[model samples]
Target: MQLNIFELTSIYLYITLAACAFYLAIMFFQKINRTRGSGVDLGPIFGLGFFVLFFGIVYVCWGYMHYFGYEYDFHPLPLYKTGILMTYFALIGVVFFSEKIIGKTKFAFTFFSIGCCVYGIFFTFTEFDLRLFTYITNPITVAFILISFLYFLKVKTTGEIRKQMFSAFLCYIGFLIFFLLDIEGIKALLPFPMEISSIISSIGVIITLVYLGTIFLRFETFTEFGWKDKLRELYIIAPNGTTLFHYSFIRDERNQDLDLISSGLTGVEGILGELIQSKKKLKIVDHQDIKIIFEYGEYTTIALITYENLRIYLPKLTSLRVKFEKLFQDVLKDWSGRIEVFRPANHLVNEFFG
Candidate 1:
């Protein structure tokens, strides 16, 4: 039997969502394995998988209904609006747990999400109307797009700001396509099937999933520690023995190695001071069951201490030191000594060596 456009589109969308969800689920599992002991929060990445999985289930249901020739208005399953609302909720979770936004901005996003959820629930109980659903969701989607764009514009962090913004934009445009398809007269403009809405929107979602996958691949928030010993502390010190930035992976206060490292470096600048005489780029000190690695730059010095014999990080330390000096050359020269000027160095350290 020849298939109608609606049936074809529904089948395509169902297959696409299901496939994308399956792929993401596998990636998420591997990501967890990859970051097992790195103390990295996997919530945001899990949310991404859940978001696609939730919508995939919804699309399969919708596809089954369409395949059986059950009209949405008459179908017993009132899943359409609820699915979209929950999808938005999932996206909100992604944004929240990603640690991309914090402070008052994160709070504002949370507040807006709650408002939308409450509003969507009210209408779902009362009318469950598609038009009302679209109207309510459109504003929320647009708000997400705008907020993401604003974040991308305002922030200078190393996180995937552009990818996040573009993903939100794709979602908004996908919803727009879905909305336009349901309009009274817009259907006449397209000679194709009304189900083109599903096709277009599914394409948008597929693109979004692809983008997210790329973000996942490029993600370096977590590092695999094959052994029990792990990197415990990292610090950048200025030429004047000033602490420019400090990061500690060891959470326990009892582990005073970080303090000792700082104090020892402050007094003599042992490895840092030796850089001029030895003319060496990297130095390694294995002292008292800890390995301290130093990478010297023209204006700044980088120090890393780890319990493990992780010799592979020496090159990374050198690269970080070089980038730090180059990126903060002007500030290093002026040296007002206010630590705030080097706040950005925190992000650099985390991104490059954390």
Candidate 2:
């Protein structure tokens, strides 16, 4: 069947969108594997992957409807509803990432996300009413955008992070605006010649790709961690000076001698405690180019090696120790000398350090 000029342009744009969504989902899922132990949260990446997977399906169905359904008056209601439903999950992924990348987030943003989740579930079961659509979206979605944007704006951070944040903001804002205008009455109002809205919506796909690249780069270079400089390794050593676990920040290399050195340091800490030292365990000791900061727990000592003094990260270290002890409290009391028992602590390190 022959199509009009405007319909053809829209078909092309929506097809482009479908392709972008498919690739975007692949990118996020690839990043999920790529970013392991890199201290970037997987929750957001997982959420986005799910979002784009559904998004691609949504657009594919829409494209099919546009191309063939024009004559038949067809609407793929179930597919559309399912895709729209995933929008709530998309916000969940972005929100999880935002708190870490942006700053301490307001409670309202989370509340709005939960509210949208309810709306999404509700809409999926019931037939959509445009009268209800605008009313449901107007207050909540708009406020969610504003509240999230304003919170990020007020957060004080480095120039580099802020630039990336703006890129994220652009991608997010563009997607929401495009999503809002996607309904029948509003879509019909667009200029029939070029279907400018479709073209603009396609731009959001580009923005999303760029934003994802920036996030991947930031995690790779470890520059996103403004507070850390040359973080080398983390070791959790038992009180008996056996290395329970060792995690290296940089990939593809491990210092085998660190176990011996850490054992010796534990010895030194004990010796110094006895020789002209109070019972206080040595917290930090300086080497030529690296600083070792240790946090003592009832069952273990947590050692972090870095180029710069990380006394400032003591709170995180302390928190890790607390959580680890709680998580492994029973295991510690019965304390098998086996080091593998504490492998779960790696996740705690990612959470606190990331």
Listed in order, each prediction's TM-score against the native is: 0.57, 0.54
Each model's lDDT comes to 0.60, 0.66
User: How many pairs collide in each candidate, listed in order?
Assistant: 0, 0
- For 1-354, candidate 1 gives per-residue lDDT tens digits of 566766576677767776876677677767767866655556555655665556556556556655554343344345555555655665555455333333335456556665776767675553336446656665665566456545543452322444544565555556446635534356567778656655665666666565655655454432221221367778788767667778777777453454455667654445565766755444666665677777778887778878754534766687788888888889889889787777787777676654
TM-score of 2: 0.54
What C-alpha lDDT does candidate 2 achieve relative to the native structure?
0.66
Q: What are the runs in model 2 whose C-alpha is more than 4 Å off?
A: 38-40, 99-115, 118-126, 130-135, 178-181, 191-196, 203-218, 221-354
- The numbered model that scores best in lDDT is 2
- Residue-wise C-alpha lDDT for candidate 2, range 189-224, written one tens digit per residue: 777533555556556654665465455434432223
Q: What is the lDDT of residue 36 in candidate 1?
A: 66
